[model samples]
Target: MKSKIGIIIGREFNERVRKKSFIITTLLTPLLMLGLLVAPMLLSTYSGDEQKKIAVVDDSNIIGAHLQSTDEINFIETELPIEIARKEHLEEFAILHIGKDIMSNPSDIRLYTNSTASITMEMNIATQVKMVIENIKLQQQDIENLPAIIASIQTEVNMQSFANDTSEDSGDKANSSIVATVIAYLLSFILYMFILLYGSMVMQSVIEEKNSRVLEVMVSSVRPMEMMMGKILGVASVALLQIAIWLVIILGAGYFIIPELIPDEVAMAVAMLQQGASPETLNTDTDMSLLQAIATLTDVGYLAKIVVSLVVFMTGGFLLYAALFAAVGSAVDTPQDAQQLQTPITIPIILSLFVMLSVINDPGSDLAFWFSMIPLTSPIVMMARIPYDIPTWEILVSLGILVATFIATAWAAGKIYRTGILMHGSKPSFKELWKWLRFK
Candidate 1:
């Protein structure tokens, strides 16, 4: 019996793996994901290379001297009326008009642009003007170097967090909430995608075979139970293979390529973070938040735990859903017919995704814990909680429940599959499905 199932599994596996679609998708998906991550950074860097020149008509003459130039924008002072500046300096991006009474009537200041202005550009100009107005107000009071006093007292707070689960010595190393949140979001999403995509693949495959009458020939020799298990396992092997390939690509880039690609300032910032340095101690030019995130992701032990948890949950989740999908496939003659039956199965999966969003915010919440305990939702909800370094006992209980649920679900689905695989012509109603479950 096992040999027969193995043969069927081999046939199904080879058939799909040999397809051009499989090979193309396996190779291109990583590149597409990479593009999504890199595109924003590239656009931010080069999209505004040309500096926007603003013709400043400082009627008060107080604002222009304080106005500064950034790489993306320049403030050019022009000795002309606001109207003249707008008309004559058509080549400039905008005309900034400042009223003489601007100290009291701040609304008198305006910007006339040749075209629509971006929020960022408008905010920049408004900020500069607002600062000048404040300084003027301060000078009117005749205080002793008030501007320098304010600048000297400027301060920002950076709070370092450590997990209570760590040892006393390990408490010195701060944990990043941002890293945990990002990892949780990504893992949950990946688990959701894997379950939905692979589970549907099993359904579609069953539908195609049943419609083509290929299953009629194959099931004559192999038992329906064996065929069902064989098909589920076959497709599962393919999914695992694709995931392994993706992991290799991702880990290789994270460990070997990405570190080399990051700027030296980023590395220095990460090093400072490890040594318990405050945000103020790191180079102001470096993006400390991004560097800290990268450093946490590249941790060998942490990454390994996340990957293992994902694979375990992914396998259990897919199998549990895939069996139900196969049963739905066997009952229906077409994809349209399967839709009504699949709704109940799909709702839990969809609900889990929505719940995952909330889980990232509070992994220890009662809602997260209960949802993670429920087998139908645990795969996604638990993966989200895993990155937060939740208790190991909770994970073990979730995994045990998931395994038991999969076994029970597969057995129940097997009964439906064996009966539904042979029945045809008419769609089965709830009553008819109940009868099939009771069949000897």
Candidate 2:
């Protein structure tokens, strides 16, 4: 019996793994993720290089001199009238018109452009004019060195945060909640997608085989329960393999790329700390939050724990949901027919994703704890809390519940699949399915 199940598992596994779509997807997914990460930075770097010139027809006359050129914009003062400047400087990006309100009415300023201007461009013109007017008013008050006084008093504060608890290694170090949230969100979303993607794959495969009468041939020599388990486990192995490959590629790239991002002085400061130098001896301006974020991600122990938890939860979650999907597929003759039956199974998965957002903000909240404990929602909710260093006992309990739930679900699904796999030409109601479950 075991050998027969193993054959089905091997056959299902090899059939998908050998497909060109699988091979292409496995190779391209990491590259696509890398592109998503790097594209914004590259665009920001090159987007501001070309400056747009604006012809200034400042009726107030004093404001034009204060207008400065930035990487994205250039202000050129024009002696021509506003109407003439609009026509003559049509080649320019825009014409800035500052009213001769001479002392008040800041609303009189306007920007006329040859073409439609971006909000950024309009904001830039308004900001420069406003600053110039304010400075002029301050100077007219006859205060001594007012500009210098304001400049001297200008200050900026960058706050650093640290966790209160000192028991764990992460507790003593500075923490970046932004970085933690991003990581948590990414992990949870990936887990959610994996379960849905692979679970649906199992359903679709079952439906396709049933439609083609392939399952009829196989069931002659195999039990429905064995066939269902074999297909679920087979697709699970394929999902895990794909994830393993993605982790290797992403981690390998991060290892090489992260060091290049660190400045030489910062790298030296990190080395100094490792060599027994005190934190005070290093550069005071070093961004501790960024450093800590980098250190947290690269920590071998933390990474291993996360990876292990991901595999465990992903497997358990996929199995719990896939069994229902397989059972639904077996009961229906077509893909459209299966949709109506799959709604009950899909609701928990969708609800879990929405609840994960709140869990990220307050991982220790009662809402998070309860959701993470429930087997149906635990996989995503628990992963969101893991990055915050939740208690180990909670994780163990959650895993235990998830495992027990999967076993019970698979058992129930097996009963349904046994009868439904042979049924044809009719759709089963909820009452009918319940009767099939009790078939002696």
Candidate 3:
């Protein structure tokens, strides 16, 4: 029985890996994901380099001079009226007017642009105006050594955090979140694609064997349970191989290419740090020691505990659903009939994704905890919650439920497959399926 299962699994794996579709999809998916990860950074850099010209119609020279020297802004003096500027499509020109109360109220300066200013441009203008006001006040007080006093007065706060009775830097939180989000997304998407890919492969294999009447010959050699297990294991092995290859590619890219290809924003942030700017000010805070943090979070001696837990849950989740798909395929005479049954299975996955998004906003919510505990939703939901730190007992309980579901579903699915594979030509109803399940 073991040897027969092994042979079947080997055949299934060989057939799937040799297919061109599997090869192409496996290679293309990671590259596409990498592109998506980097696209926003590339676009932002391109936009930042594009010069935006602005015209200053400063009735009082105070606001205009201050706005001119601000970063990333090229300000030009404009004597033209605001109405004329608008009529001429003057995005290249804008007006800055000091109201009649400028002497007593310098804040009464109005900026008139044909269009709204970019966020960076607006921030730069505000900063420059604030600096000018500070300088004016200092001069009014006849203060000397103002620059030294300002430099000395700027206080930097160093914040730290504690988790699991150990000190942790506050900077670790952002990095941890990113790592968790990336891992959760990767695991969830993999589960999703594999179930669709391998489950369809299982269904198609069953249909082809049934159509060619080869299943009858095979059944004489192997038990129905063995045949089903072999098919699932074989396809699963193929999926595992593809996943292994992807991991290798990702790890290689992270070590070899990612540093070189770091986005300009990230690079600029690093440069700022080299020049003594605080990480909070520059906003490039991905420098957390993820390896250390993961170790701390698990409190387990090995990383394999979390890894094994994820694999077990995912495998159970995949097989549980795959068995249903196989049963559906067996009961149907054609692919069209199989597709109709797919909607019910698909709805849970779609709902799981929506729930995962909600987890990002509120990981500690009761909704998240309950969703992660339910076997049907647990695989994806629990994987998402891992990054946010779930209790060890919860993980164990979820895994236990998932494994039990897989066993029960596989047994029931085998019953359906055994009857449906040999008896075809009509779609089976729920009542007929129950009858098939009871058949000796």
C-alpha lDDT (0 to 100) for residue 22 of candidate 3 = 88
User: What are the TM-scores, per candidate, against the unseen true structure?
Assistant: 0.90, 0.90, 0.74
Poorly placed runs, candidate 2 (over 4 Å): 1-3, 138-152, 169-171, 268-281
lDDT (tens digit, per residue) of candidate 3 on 1-440:
44599888888888779989989988998999889988999987887676666666655555556555433567776676655654664556345555545546757766667677767666676677666667666778977887789899998554422224234343232224544566667666667667677778788778787778787898989988888888887877777788778767876666567557666666565444434344457554454233223323333222345466556766777787778777777788788877876677777777777798787666679988888888777777887777555577888888888888888988998998899889868877778988999999
lDDT of each residue in 360-402, candidate 1, tens digit only: 9999999999999999999999999998878889999999999
Count of residue pairs whose backbone atoms collide, per candidate: 0, 0, 0
Model 1, residue 385: distance off in Å is: 1.4
Two-way lDDT contest, 1 vs 2, winner:
1
Better of 1 and 3 by lDDT: 1
Q: lDDT for each of the candidates?
A: 0.86, 0.85, 0.70
Candidate 1, residue 232: the lDDT equals: 96
TM-score, candidate 3, is 0.74
Q: What is the lDDT of residue 196 in candidate 2?
A: 86
